[model samples]
Each structure stands twice: as structure tokens, then as C-alpha cells.
Target: MTSQEIFAQIKKKASFLCVGLDPDPQRIPKHLLKEKDPVLTFNKIIIDHTIDHAVAYKPNLAFYEAMGPAGLETLAKTLEYLPEEVFTIADAKRGDIGNTSRLYAKAFFEQMNFDAITVAPYMGEDSVGPFLAFDGKWVILLALTSNQGSQDFQLIENKEGKPLYASVLEKSKTWGTTENMMYVVGATRGESIAEVRKLVPEHFLLVPGVGAQGGSLEEVAKYGMNNQCGLLVNSSRGILYASAEKDFGEAAKKEALALQTDMAQLLDSYCK
Candidate 1:
């Protein structure tokens, strides 16, 4: 989807919440294992329950890839089942040579039809350029992540005295416009979101460290929000694993509603 379309959905839903579908078989409710495909069944239930409160759904590729072919099939079916109006993201974090990158883009954008894919920029423009070539699709490049290890490389200063992530943001802008590009600024890096916003004010950000990861939603909205409410804050374990019983879906919805309510309030206060 284009930036305009995504922003429109954000307005329509009064939400920028992106539900992360990172299902772990071991963590899924035991009752679901009786189904034909427990993982797929669990996902459908979550989607059905939380669709109204979310404008996006991101399925981290690792979860499905670990399950092998059956897991991949589940992902395909899950994508097909999602509401077309809600933006979809394949959290694949793929980056490779030009030829391989093109294939990765085709797999997610053409075959699976995801609205966006998370990409790594370590290989520079050639690795990311192919993904940018696709129309109406997005490349969510990793910038300042929330993980403990991010400081190992992303925060390192370059010769110009700029952090490596700052250079990544500055240089990658030339590869794609704000319309088709975004940065993954983790909510854990609360202060860095403001720093990233100054570099690319109009671009969207897919933030993924709230809830289970303990990133402050209020702090994220305060420092990261722009005119378009440029944030897709994600919650995986906190929402998905809210309960281990048969009411799992309902529990998930409750968690999502809580986040959506806060988001609506933030939008009213900031976007208005």
C-alpha cells in the first residue's frame, strides 16, 4: 500500500497498531493442537478477534520458517485470510546481492502480496534498491533497533562523527522516497525515535518493542509521532499470549483494545 493509503487507514481506524503474529507452537494454547493445523487456526482466531483494533498485522518470518513447509503454507493461508484494507508486513529482514534481493522482493510483494517487508541495509543500496523498485510496496529498513546488541554497531560513530544508523538514514533516503520507504525505530530506543524523525520527518516508522518488551507507548508517541501519526507500534507476546486458555482470542482482543484506546487518545491530542 502507498503511504497515503496507509495513513488513511490509520485515520479511519484511529489506530497505528500493528499486531505481531509471531506464533510459537509451544506457546500456543494446547487446545488448539487438536485442529488440522494448530498454528493456522491460532492465527485466524487472533486476526478475527483483533482486526478491528489494528491497522496492520506483521507475521515474523522466523516463526513460520521454523515450521518448514507446513509453516509456510500456514503463512500463505493467513495472508490470504487477512483483511485487504489492513496493511501486512513480512518481517523477513532480508538483504542480499542485487539478484537475490530482487527475488526476495518478488516473493513477498508478488507471490505472497505483502504490503511491506523489513530489510537490512548493511549491504548498502544494491541490496535494498531492488526492493524499492516494486511499486506500491514498502522497504522498512532497520535503523536504531531496541535489542541490547544494537549498540555494537548501530551506535558506533563513523569518521564524520555521526552514528552508523544516522548515516544509514541519511544515505538510504536517496534510494526511495518517504512514500515507499520507512525505518524501524524500536520503541525501546525512545530518544532515538526523535533523532530519527528529524532526519526523515515524513517517513513512517515500524516500532516493535512495546508491551512485552516494556517500551513506553506514551514516550514513543510523544517523540516519534509526526503529522501523519507516523508510527506502527507492534505488540507480539504481550497480546498473543495474553492467555493460554480457550479464551485466548478474547484475551488477545482485550490487550489490543487497551493499546488501541491509548493510541486513539494520542492521535486526538497530537494529530488534531
Candidate 2:
């Protein structure tokens, strides 16, 4: 999907919510296990329940890769269930040599048909350029992340006294336009998002770490939002595991609605 299309969905839904579909096989509701594909069954229910409030869905690839071929099949089937109006993100965080990146882009963009994929930018422009070569696809490059380990490399000061992540934003912006590129700015980083906004004012940011990670939504909007509401805040464990019973779908819906409601208010407050 194009950035214009994604922003339209955000406006239509009154939300920039991206539900994370990182389901753990062992944690799936016991009732679903009897089905031929429990993970896919659980995912479909989540999609049906939360589709109204969310403009996007992000399925982290590790969860499916852990289960091997069957899990990968289930992941593809889950994509089939999602309506085309909403964006789909493969949280693969893949970056490699140009040749390998081309195949990775093909697997996710052509074969799997995801609208976007998360990519690590450590390998420089060549590793990321192939993904950008695809039409109407996106490369969400990692910048300041939510994890504690982010401080290890992302914060190191360069010779110019700029932090590594700021340097990342500086150089990587030359690679792709706002329509085809975005940065992964962790919500847990708080006001750091404002720094990112200044660097790339119009680019969309795929933000994870809101609900369970304790990143305040209000803080994210106050500093990160542009006139276009440039953010796709994600919640995984908080929504996916909201309930362990048959009411899981309903529970997920409720959780998503609560976030969406909050997001609507934020958009009204900030987008003005």
C-alpha cells in the first residue's frame, strides 16, 4: 500500500493502531488446539475482532519461523483472511547483502504479499536498497528501539557528537522517500521520538512497545505526530493474551477498541 493509502485508512478508522500478531503456539487458547491449525484459527479470530479499530496488522516472523513449515503456511493463510484495505506488515527485521535482500524482498513482498517489512540498517544502503526497488512496498528501518540493549549501539556518539541513531536517520534518508521508507522508533524511548520527527518530519514511523511496554501513547503523539499523524503504534502481548478462554476474541476486541479510542482522541488533539 502507498503512504497515501495508509494515511487514508488511519483517517477512516480514526486510528493508527497496528495489532501485533506474534502468537506463541504454547500460549494459544487450549480450545483452538483441536483445530487443524490452532495458530491460524486464533489469528483469524483476532483479525475479525480487531479489524474495525486497526489500520494495520504486524506479524512478527520469528513466531512463525519457530514452528517450521506448517507455521509459515499458517502465516500465509492468516494474510489471506485480512482485508486489503488495511496494511499488512511482516516484522521480519531482515537485512543482508543485496543479492540475499532481493530474495527476502521477493519472499515477503511477491510470494507472501506483505505491504511492508522491517529491516535492520546495520549493513548500509546496499543491504536495504533491493527492498526499496519493489513498487508500492516499504522498508521500515530500525532506528531507536525499545529494548535496553538499544543503548549499547544506538546511543554511541560519533566524531560529530551525534548519536548513532541520529546518524542513522541522517544517512538513511537519502536511500528512499517518505512513501517507500519509514523508521522503527520504539515508543518506550519517550521524547526521543521528537528527535526523530525533526530529522524526517514527513516519514511514517512504525512504533512498537505501547501497552505492555509502558510507553505512554500521549507522549508518543505529543512529540512524534505530524499533521499526517505519522505513527503506527503496536501492541502484541497486551492484546493477543488479553484472555485465555473462549472469550479471547471478544477480549481482544475490547482491548483494541480501548487503544483505538485513545488514538482517536490523540489524533484529534495532535493532528489539528
Candidate 3:
């Protein structure tokens, strides 16, 4: 989907919520384990229940990759099942040499047909450029992440006195326009989001680390939002594992609805 289309969906749904479909078989309700393909079944239920409240669905590739061949098959099926109008992100975080990166882009954009794919910029533009070559597909580069380890490299200042992530945001703009490029600014780094916004005011941000990660939705919206309501705040465990019973889907829907309602109000307050 193009950036315009994604923003349109957010307006239509009154939401910019992106549900993370990171299902851990062990954490899912035990009742679902009895199914032939429990992970797939669990994902379908979550999607069905939360689709109305989310504009995007992100399936972290690790969850499916860990399941081996069957896991990959399940991911393929899940992608096919997702509603076409809703954006899809393959949080694969793949980055390598130029040739390898090209193949990775084709894998997700052509083979899998994901609307976007999370990419690592550690290898510079060569690693991320191939993904941007695909028209209408997005490259969500890792910027200031929420994890504890992000302090190790992302925050390190170079001789120019700029943090590594700041350079990533600055240099990457030349590689792709706001229409096809986005940055992953974690929700826990809420206070710094304004700084990020100043660097790339028109680009979108795919923010994780809310809910189960204890990031504040209000703080993120306050600092990160732009005229387009440029944020896709994700909630994974908090919504996915809301319950461990047969009513888990209903519980997930409730969590999503709560987030979507907050997002709707934020959109009205900020975008209007």
C-alpha cells in the first residue's frame, strides 16, 4: 500500500493501531494447542477479532521461523488470510550485502506480498536500498528502539557529536522518500520522538513497546504525532495474550478497541 492509502485507512477506521501477531505457542491458550495448526488458528482468531480496530497487522518473523518449516508455511497462510485493505508488515529486520538484501526484499515484497518490512541499517544504504526499490512497499528502518541494548549502539555519539540513530535518520532520507520509508521509533523512547519528528516530519513511524512493554500511549502520541497522525503504535502481548481461555479472541478484541478509541481521540485532537 502507498502511504496515502495507509493514512486513508487510519482516517476511515479512526485508528492507527497495528496489532502485532507474535504468537508464542506456549503462551497461547491451551485449548488452541489441540488444533492441528495451533499457531495459525490462534493468529486467525486474533486477526478476526481485532481487524475492525487495527489498520495494520505485523507478524514478527521470528515467531513463525522458530516453528521450522511448518512455521514458515503457517506464516504464508496467515499472510494470505489477512484483509487486503489493512497494511501488513513482516517484522523480519533483514539486512545484509546488496545482493542478499535484494533477495530479502523480493522475498517479502514479491513472494510474501507484505506492505512493509522492518530493516536494519547497520550495513548502510546498500542493505536498505534494495527494499526501497519496490514501488509501494515500505522500508521501516530501525532507529531508536525501546530495548535495553539500544543504548549500546544507537545512542553512541560519533566525532560529529550526533547520535548514531540521528545519522541514520538524516542519511536515510536520501535513499527513499517519506512515501516509501519509515523509521521504527520505539514507544518507550517517547520523550525523544519529538526529536525524531523534527528530522523527518513527513515520514511515518512504526512504534512498538507499548502495553506489555509499559510504554505510555499518551506520551508517544504527544511527541510523535504529525499532521497525518504519523504513528502505527503496536501492542503485541498485552492484546494477544489478554486471556488464556477459550474467550481469548474476545479479550484481544477488547484490548484493541481500548487502544483504537484512544487513537481516534488523538487523531481528532491532533490531525484536526
* Highest lDDT model number: 2
- Estimated TM-score for each candidate: 0.99, 0.99, 0.98
lDDT of 1 by residue, 67-178 (tens): 9988889999999999899999999999999999999999999999999999999999999999999889999999988888998999999888899999999999989998
Regions of model 1 farther than 4 Å from truth: none
Q: Per-residue lDDT of 106-180 in model 2, one digit per residue for the tens?
A: 999999999999999999999999999999999999999998899999999989889999999999999999989
Please tell me which model should have the higher TM-score, number 2 or number 3: 2
Query: Candidate 2 at 76: error in angstroms?
Result: 0.6
Q: What's the residue-level lDDT of 91 in candidate 1?
A: 98
lDDT, candidate 2, equals 0.94
The TM-score of predicted model 3 comes to: 0.98
* Candidate 1 residue 246 C-alpha distance from true site, Å: 0.2
lDDT of each: 0.93, 0.94, 0.92
Range of the 10 consecutive residues with the lowest summed lDDT in candidate 3: 186-195
Q: How accurate is candidate 3 locally (lDDT)?
A: 0.92
Lowest lDDT block of 10, candidate 2 = 186-195
Answer with 1 or 2, whichever has the higher lDDT. Answer: 2
Which digits, one per residue and each the tens of the lDDT, describe model 3 over residues 177-235? 99899999988866689889889898999999998777898888888888888899998
Clash pairs, model 2 backbone: none
